[model samples]
Target: MTPELLRARIKGGEPLMDLDLRQLVLTPGDYAGAVFMRCDLRGVNLAGVDLRDSQFIRCQLQDTIWDGAQLDQCVFHGSNASGARMRAASIKEMNWSDSQAIGMDMSEAQWVSVNFVKTDMTDVCLKGASLKQVSFTECAWGKADMSGTRQEQVLYMYGDLTQALLQDAHWDGVVCVESDLSGQDFHGQTLQRCQLTECRLEGCNFQDALLEQTNFKGAFMRGAKLINARASRAMFVYADLQEAHCQGGRYTQSLWADACLDHADLSGADLTQSILHRTRCNGASFMNAELEYADFSYADVSRADFRGSRFMRTQFHRALIAGTRWGNKAGVLEKDPLLFEAEQWSAGRPTAPRAGY
Candidate 1:
């Protein structure tokens, strides 16, 4: 059934079945409480219309326009709506599961209590939108624009958000477990109590972002850029952050226990009162980085590079340090009693220091 046929049927009180309304134009129309399952409404113009409580199951609505439309309690399951326009629309309690909606624009829209489970929303634009209680499970949002979007209780569990733009986006209680967010742009974004466990965050830029109490456990963050990021009491336990760039980032009482940070760059980073127990930092660079009262107990510093790094009371207990560079820093190398006894400095021996003193 086509759109005209469906409209005629609605006028004549008839039922629609398996309608193929591809490229239909229904602009400024009232389609409230309509049931349109398995329809092909591609390239349709549904602008400024009322589509409340409508059902669009398994529909192909690619390149469709629904700008300034009202879609309350609507269901769009398994739909392919790529290149669609839904700007400034009111979408409350909508279901869009397992759908592909790439490159769609929904700027300044109001999305409340919407469920977008397992959807591929790559390159979609939702800038300056109002999202409340929105749930997204196992979705791919790579290169998506979420700048200046305001959201609360948004769920993004196991989602791949690599290279997505989230600049100046404000999120509250966002859950992102096992997601790959490598090389994503998160400049000036504010996260409150966000959880990012087991995610791949290599080369991610978080410049001047506010990450209060963020949880980043077991994440692989090699060469990530977090310059000027404000993190207070952030937890990064068991994380593999080899060669990460954390320049000028602020950390107060941060926890990085058992982290593998080999060859990581922390130039000019403020790690005051931080705790790093049992960390493996072989070949890590901390040039001009603040280490005031930071604990490094039971850490493996073998082949690590801490040249030109500031250290005050930075403990190094039982740390292996073969060929490690410690440039002009006064610190104690506490040896464990259970390890082998320290040998004396013998002249003309293989294990002797140079006689340049």
Candidate 2:
């Protein structure tokens, strides 16, 4: 059908079905309340168009351009939008389920209350976009670019965002549960109140990042780089951080209960007020680190290095200190006067100075 006829049909509240509108330029048109079923709109240019309340089912939108268009309350199911460009579009209350949007460009777009379910948006570019109340369920966004994007109340569940770019993105109240974010780079980013529980963050780079109240419970962050990062009040319960590099990082008031940090390098890290209860830090290095007010109760610190580390009020009660090196000295806890005194005090034994006669 011609574009004029399509517009007239849409104006008359008629649904356009089984139409082959491929390679058509429908710029500056209004297709509100349109219902497109099994339509082929490949390589079509719908720039500056209004497609509100539209329903696209099993449509072919490959290489289509919807730049600067309004797609509010739109539903796109089982559509293939590979290589499509929708830059600077206003997409609110949109539902895009079972869609393949590979290599799509949605840069600088505004998305509000958008739900993407079972969608494959691999290598999609959403740079500098504004996303609020957006939810992605069972989606695959591998290598997608979300740099400089602003997100609020965003949730990603059972999805794969592996190798995705999130540099300089401002995130608030963002939760990514049971997602695979492996090898993703979050260097120098500031994440506040974010939860990445049960996520696969193996080998991910969080160097120099500032994370406040961020939770990584049950996460597999082995070999991850957190050098010089500030992770205050963060939770890493049951996390596997083996061989991870956290040198010079400030993990104050953080919780690592029941977590594994074997062979992890935490040298020069400020772990003051942090809890390592039942955590395994075997062969880990804490040289020159500030462990003041840090708790290591029941933790396995065997063969760990604590040279030059400040231990004011640091608790090692019931902790395994076998073969541990403490400030240029290597021996059992019985030989170390400082450790022995702390242990004695922890056991309710009086170690105070004797009163003068």
Candidate 3:
């Protein structure tokens, strides 16, 4: 198709479907609200075109240059958009799904509410892009570079995250499910309310970061560093946190039910109002920590240290305390530990205040 022929057809409002338009020379013209289905636009130079609200379904758009195009409210479904360049494009309210966007370069683009469902985004470059309220569902990603991007409220529901590079990215309210973000650096970043359920976070650094109300349910957080992190009310239910460093952190009201805290150092940490029911706390440390209102019911605290810890209303109901060290506690001391201690474990024990009045 020639440039004049294509312009005439578009101006005449003709159906541009199932046509071989690989020979068309695109000029700066208005193609807005145009619908092209099953069209082979391979290697088309559609740069700087006005394609706003345009729909392209099952189109062959491989290596197409859409850079500086106005793609606002555009729909691109079931299209082979591999190696397409859409850099610095204004793409808002776009709905793209079931498409192959592999090796697509969308760097420095302005995206808002851009949804991609069931799409293949392998080796996609989104560096320095600004995204707001964007979502990716059931997408197959591989080595997607999201470096230096400013993102807000992004939701990723897929799990096949092969080598996602998010270096120097600013995130707010990011949520992921079953995603493997292992070995990512989140140091000192504010990740409030970020839910990473059933995800693999192995060797992830969250040191001194603000992780308030972040959910890590059924996550693998082994060797993760959370030192001095303000992670109050965070959920780690059924998470394996073996050898994780959480020393001197504020973990108030956090839940770790059936989770593994073995070999983790929580020294001088404030675990007030926390719950660890049926959890494995083997070889953990709580030295000089505050355990007020914390519950450890049915948990195994074997070989754990509680030296110089201050506890009030901290329950260890039916918990295995064998080989656990307890000393310098500010709470009620057991006077008759050899006798009536098993009775105390069976029933609620009586407490006496320190006679300092």
Candidate 4:
């Protein structure tokens, strides 16, 4: 139908149509007002075309090639564009909501102010792309290749970016609220003021990343690897980081109130000037770690290891220390219980050691 006319216009060099253009190779043409609704445009080649303000609503555009195309202000609502190739395209201010774009290769493309709301873009490639102010709200971008992408001011609320390849990407001022970033690698990335609340980040890797003032409240990061990370003024309130490997990480002035760190390894790490108020570190390892000016008030350090760790001016008031290996390398507390209780508590304060914990 319209696809035959488009091919005739491309061959006869007449003009392109504005209707359903499915399975056609009409390249090097201008396609203004191109509307492709309910069309199957699989294997169609529309490369090097100018499609200004075009719309593709409810279309099946699988394996379509749109390389080097100019698609300004275009919309792709509820379309299926799986395995499509859109490399190096100039797509500015496009809206692509609720689209199923699995396995699409959009590497090195220009996506300025694009909206990808509620789209399923699994295994898509965006390597070396500049995505400034892009909104991916409620999008499923699982296993997407975002490596080396410069993403500034991106909002990814309720998005599933689990296992995505974000290695060495610049994510400054990115907000990822309620997103699943589990098993994602953020090694050596700079993340400032990032909000990650109530997300499932189990087994995620953030090794050696500069995380200044990041909020990780109520997130589940059990068994995550954050080794050698630099975190200053970061907040982890009530977060579950059980068995996480954070060896050699710098936690200067970080706040970790009421967070669970059971069986986590913090060996050779710097915990200087950090707040660990009421934090549960049961069975955790802190061997040879720096604990200068760190607070462990009312914390549970039972069955925890702190051998050869620096504890200069570090508070240990009301902390449970049964079967704990202290800096003296002993399995028991050396001080008398009554004398230690008398040093901090007074008369009639019900200070009979608080009824043995």
Name the top TM-score candidate: 2
RMSD of each: 9.4, 7.7, 7.6, 7.2
Candidate 4 — which residues are off by over 4 angstroms? 1-18, 23-35, 39-41, 189-192, 328-357
Ordered from best to worst lDDT, the candidate numbers read 2, 3, 4, 1
Clashes of 4: 0
Poorest 10 consecutive residues of model 3 by lDDT? 331-340
lDDT of all predictions, in order shown?
Answer: 0.80, 0.89, 0.88, 0.82
lDDT of 2 at 336: 40
Off by over 4 Å in 3: 2-8, 11-13, 332-357
* Candidate 2 wrong stretches, greater than 4 Å: 2-8, 23-29, 328-357
Which of the predicted structures, 1 or 3, would earn the higher TM-score when compared with the native?
A: 3
The residue-by-residue lDDT of candidate 3 on 1-357, one tens digit each, is 667777677778776899998887887888887789999999989999988888899999999999999899999999999999999987889999999999999999989989999999999999999998999999877899998888888998855664888777777778898888888877877778888889999989888888899899999999999999999999999999999999999999999999999998999999999998999999999898889988887889899999988988687877888999999545522232533477767678667687995
lDDT of 2 by residue, 62-81 (tens): 99998987899999999999
Judge candidate 1 at residue 130 and give its lDDT. 90
- Decreasing TM-score order of the candidates: 2, 3, 4, 1
Candidates 3 and 4: which is better by TM-score?
3
Which of the two, 1 or 3, has more lDDT?
A: 3
- Name the best candidate (by lDDT): 2
TM-score of each: 0.78, 0.86, 0.85, 0.78
153-209, model 4: which lDDT tens digit per residue? Answer: 888888777778887888777788888888887888887777777888899888988
